[model samples]
Target: MYYSRKRQPDDLPQEVTAIWSCTNEECNGWMRDNFAFSAQPRCVQCNSLMEKGERKLSILENTSPNHSKKK
Candidate 1:
């Protein structure tokens, strides 16, 4: 039996999403804005300040009851 591990294009739906990107050039850390716990989030990896940005990313919903979304 041959099994392919690769994901097909239709498997993931992408959208231009709001995100927080690390201000530090050395850090490649980023996260979806909707999932961020704060208005201004810090990089989880480097603890550096983050800036608002957008990227073409796979659509994912945050279903955790405790997770709040504040604009």
Candidate 2:
């Protein structure tokens, strides 16, 4: 007998966070908010402006050494 099922990774994350959505009419692009460095970000796919939005995605850790902090 042989197995036919694929095994899932053990490091799967369980959380949701904000993201940026592309405003392009014919493009489907989005990015994590934490990775953004500006108040308003442009879509990397079509260079269109992005809007704030929420999505249910796996948790991600931000490890940027030059991360800016707001008082």
Candidate 3:
């Protein structure tokens, strides 16, 4: 089986957004701040406590009508 090795254009708009990073060093769990519904979010992957941070991610509009503004 052969697969194309060409680098495809992934030019999506990027933004430095707020995020939650897991405090557990072994866990690599994180989430976009705007998408989080709670003042503090637990890692969905490891259920560990998370801290505030920033990351460069492809801009995404959180269109979930039920989402609440915590910050």
Top candidate on lDDT is 1
Candidate 3 to truth, TM = 0.79
Query: Candidate 2's residue-wise lDDT over 1-71, tens digit each?
Result: 99766645555666778899999989999988888888899998999999999998877777898766443
Worst 10-residue lDDT window for candidate 2 reads 5-14
- For candidate 2, the per-residue lDDT at 9 reads 52
**Candidate 2: what lDDT?**
0.85
Q: lDDT of each prediction vs. the true structure?
A: 0.93, 0.85, 0.87
Q: Lowest lDDT 10-mer window, candidate 1?
A: 62-71
TM-score of each: 0.83, 0.76, 0.79
* Candidate 3: regions farther than 4 A off: 1-9, 69-71
**Candidate 1 Cα outliers beyond 4 Å, as residue runs:** 4-10
Total clashing pairs for each candidate: 0, 0, 0
Question: Candidate 1, 52: how far from true, in Å?
Answer: 0.3
lDDT of 3 by residue, 1-71 (tens): 99987745476768899999999999998999988868889999899999999998888888788977655
